[model samples]
Target: MKSNLLSLEMMNGQERLHEALEMRGFLVKKEGPFLMLASGSSKRDLRSLKMLLNKLHIPIFWNGDRFQLLTNKFPVMMMKKITEHRGEEFPVSMEGYHFRWRAFVNRKNGLKVDALDLDPHIACFVKAVNEAGIPCLAGCDGHLKHAPNLQFSGVYSGAWFQIIQEQYLSEFELNYTWNVEFKGGSGSRLVASKARNERWDRHKIYEDTLKMAYKLKEHADEIKKRKASSFKRNAGMKEEAEGLRTDGRFEELVDWMERLSN
Candidate 1:
């Protein structure tokens, strides 16, 4: 499968590589330098393709149908740093907050040497969502006169915001109301407004946004644990299946294979 999937010669150009992907039953589209695979592709097929590519030292980002071959220009090290710093405590000072904010933004938008002139209050939330693997596009602290908001890209952004709303923000909803505004293909915005007639306080908004960041980290960690566990289980099942085939236990192997499929 690996040999037939792609050859070293095919990697010479995007046009040739995309043709190979289409022949292998992938519905492919080219968006700038990114190759977008249609969501209709099976998960197992996508996983197998990703594994093969990784073994060849090619990096690919597979998020549902949005598969893209990451170029050398991609901020791989910065992204690793963001993931590594996921467990760090919220920034206590303005400088610390800017540092975290710059890391997250640069990971998504490439390097930005200039200081990020964003509101310090919104920095923690920006860092949180981006590090959680949800691409945050824009954010504002709303000062003391307006509602604080964060914008995220892609269709899944709305679903991610829903999870944070239903599971993480339940307790905070009493004092501060949150809502998601979907902009069709433009992505979604998560806005935080005051509950009832209570006026917006900048300090409370900053504190609440920090709490939301913590909850986002907790959610991201849970996802990582589940993925790790699933990978181990699948690996063990594959080893058992291979052993069963080698030992000529056809009937037992069939049963084991069925279990593994489930």
Candidate 2:
């Protein structure tokens, strides 16, 4: 086992990940339902993956997409300067697939009685034990096999977004950690968390979100358009309105224009 772990560390990052998955019982082929990649488990990786997911167009409520993320998501990447504090978790990252099938499924976040943050390697074994991600952490007290160094845990909040069974497969050969999950998620993400939140007007919320993002991209254009226009026509715009409404100064000018038009 020590030799295997050493060889894994010696392998390039991607190879280490694939090897780990295979060791855990998954058979990796050149052509499979998914292709996996690995990267730094650093703060940069965490932030980037978070953004990717936040902007991803996949619909989580659907079974097919849920299957995709839960199974194929990459390990969570967070860094702690202190070796003891440093731990990792996983999040699904599916592309070219759809988990609409998840719409037919119903699941909840792991009972969060006492959520925890532990080593990534140990977390995989926990996943192995529960046969589901319903438990936030699996103890590293040698209760599980193949991971002696396993003494920590953490979770993916998005785990509850959707859960699918088909895309969820395992090759458990005595507890090795995989770098990523597989066979999950169809891309082209649209925000669905909004719909999940009680305070949100999902449709209107996301519409405005998208509008704001688009508006940010065309900042210069909005500025030029507002400057060139003689008549301001944005008086009654909804407060929720996003985008560069008549250049970047739309809000500042709205009151004056509203008074004039009235």
Candidate 1 residue-wise lDDT, 1-262, digit = tens: 1223455444544554454443223335687666764433334545545654565565667666556655633333333222222121222212222222223222322111101233556655665565555556556777667888866653234434454456556765434777776543324578887766788886677567766765665575554333233223344654664465345454464344334323
Best by lDDT: 1
lDDT of 2 by residue, 1-262 (tens): 3223355335443344343332221222232433232221223433332333345432222232211233323232311111122233434333221222122122222222111233322322332222232222222322222213211121111221112111122222212222212111221111222122234332232223223222222242332232224222243432212232223333333343333323
Error of 2 at 240 (Å): 58
Q: Candidate 1: minimum summed lDDT over ten consecutive residues — where?
A: 108-117
Estimate candidate 1's RMSD in Å.
22.2
Clash pairs for candidate 1: none
Report lDDT (CA) for all predictions: 0.49, 0.26
